[model samples]
Target chain A: AQSVAQPEDQVNVAEGNPLTVKCTYSVSGNPYLFWYVQYPNRGLQFLLKYITGDNLVKGSYGFEAEFNKSQTSFHLKKPSALVSDSALYFCAPPTNTGFQKLVFGTGTRLLVSP
Target chain B: GAGVSQTPSNKVTEKGKYVELRCDPISGHTALYWYRQSLGQGPEFLIYFQGTGAADDSGLPNDRFFAVRPEGSVSTLKIQRTERGDSAVYLCASGSGPSGANVLTFGAGSRLTVL
Candidate 1:
């Protein structure tokens, strides 16, 4: 079974500062990890994904994620945060094990204050 | 082309009423997905369609929830005998290729409220 966990319920950051949203996973084989953002009354927007390759993966909106096999973690990061970046962040384990259905975390609310 | 689209941005119904939510995927995208998001929670997978067939429907809460994609372009999710517990946002997403890449584009979800 593939599953994801985002420990924090909410994370607070300031505009122009660095930001990080953490995630970890549990699966039998290699994992496909993803990061998505959801603003109020909107659908989730894909941020990044790590399937295979280097540990560091860059994605849309200047976002990036680091995959650590030993730690079973894939964390989303950005060098400079924006008030516009404030939203709900979700970490998901790709649904690839026969079913191809993703299992998502509880979501972490990112509040980037200016 | 346009991104994935969903119909009836908001749907309100009584507890026993039935409701159907629709989704139109990208022109050539073959993989489509349906998920449910409750207040303060992340989206939960309900079903996934690979072409015209339902490849997975494991996340569906129960038999009351049904979906179809006969033409492989547009799809509809039907919920019968809705309950208060059914109140949530129904989100639809589409991705390109069979690999189910990380490039899943989502539609503005349909908000369903059961009274």
Candidate 2:
């Protein structure tokens, strides 16, 4: 039962404000975490990943995530929110089965108001 | 060619009918994967292919679902006796390596609606 959880169903932020979409994991050993975003009617696009190295990983579209081992969390964050950034985001961590299969979280919807 | 490509972007069919969704991975990619996404859920792993062989099919829900990667380039996911619950977007992704460290490139996905 290794899995990732997105506690929030939706997060709202005013444009130009900082925003955070939370994610937590339940897994053994050092985890490789990933974040993906899906716009309406489009497939998911990779945002960023944490494999090993700096806890702060930068991704596309000015998005970044901080991997916190103590809290077992890898939350997606942005310094300035944009209405264009609003979409569905998912937190994924690889399954322990030794395969490349990723176990994805339910997903969090981010909405930035103008 | 440019990226992971899927065919029949949308499909609507009656229950109990058979459906086939195809995927063509990026050139030179050795790993291919299939995932299903429901209305409000994240993409769920369905199968994984390493070259011409199926490295893992454990995520497939039942025997009704089957997939094949003939010649190690293209893949087709087949569903028999389709149920309404089977309606979801089937996504195909490809990676350059066999390890989880490789970032996957996903296709737009094939939306299947079982009536």
Candidate 3:
């Protein structure tokens, strides 16, 4: 079985401050982790993915995720949060035992206040 | 099309009605996926297709839910005896290359409302 957990239902950050949305996963073998963002009434947009190699993966909109093997975590981060950065963030791993499909977390709502 | 496209952007129907949703994957994309997203939750995988064949459908909730990609280009998801619980936004996505990379291009989902 493969699954992901996003502990926070919502995360609040001030504009210009760094923000982090936590994610953890359970997988049988090497994991492929991903981050997606969804705005209201819109489909999800791919942010970043961690396949292998470097622990830190940079993505669109000045977002990055750090994959921690020991911790089984891949937390999304941004150095300077903007109000436009506010959206729903999801953590996903390959569905089932393979990499064809994806199983997503419950998602965390990010709010960047000005 | 430019990206994955789903038809019937919004649907409202009563329980027990049959409904069909359609998806048009990106040109040259061999892999397509269907997912359902409930309010306040992330999208849940429903099915995956590698060309015209259904590579995996383990995520489908029940036998009443069926999908086909006969031509390997466009796909349709048919739901029989729709129930209130089936109401959710159905999303479609397309990707290229091997399944390992799993990079998908998504479409604005079709919102289904079952009353």
How much is A9 displaced in model 3, in angstroms?
A: 0.9
Cα lDDT, all candidates: 0.89, 0.94, 0.91
Write the residue-wise lDDT of candidate 2 on B16-89 in tens digits: 99999999999999999999999988899999999999999988999999999989999999999999999999
What would you estimate as the lDDT of candidate 1?
Answer: 0.89
iRMSD for every model? 1.9, 0.9, 1.5
lDDT of 3 by residue, A1-114 (tens): 878999999999999999999999998888888898998888989999999999999999999999999999999999999999999998888865454677787899999999
TM-score of chain A for each candidate? 0.95, 0.96, 0.95
lDDT of 1 by residue, A1-114 (tens): 778888889999999999999998888788888888998789999888888889999988899999999999999999999999989998887755553476777899999999
Task: Summing lDDT over every window of 10 consecutive residues in candidate 2 chain B, give the lowest-scoring window.
Answer: B95-104
Quality of candidate 3's docking, in CAPRI categories? Answer: medium
Worst 10 contiguous positions by lDDT, candidate 3 chain A: A94-103
Off by over 4 Å in 2: none
Docking class of 1: medium
Question: Candidate 1 — which residues are off by over 4 angstroms?
Answer: B100-102
Indicate the TM-score of model 3: 0.95
Candidate 3: where is the Cα deviation over 4 Å? none
Full candidate order by DockQ, most accurate first: 2, 3, 1
Cα deviation in Å at residue A45, candidate 2?
Answer: 0.8
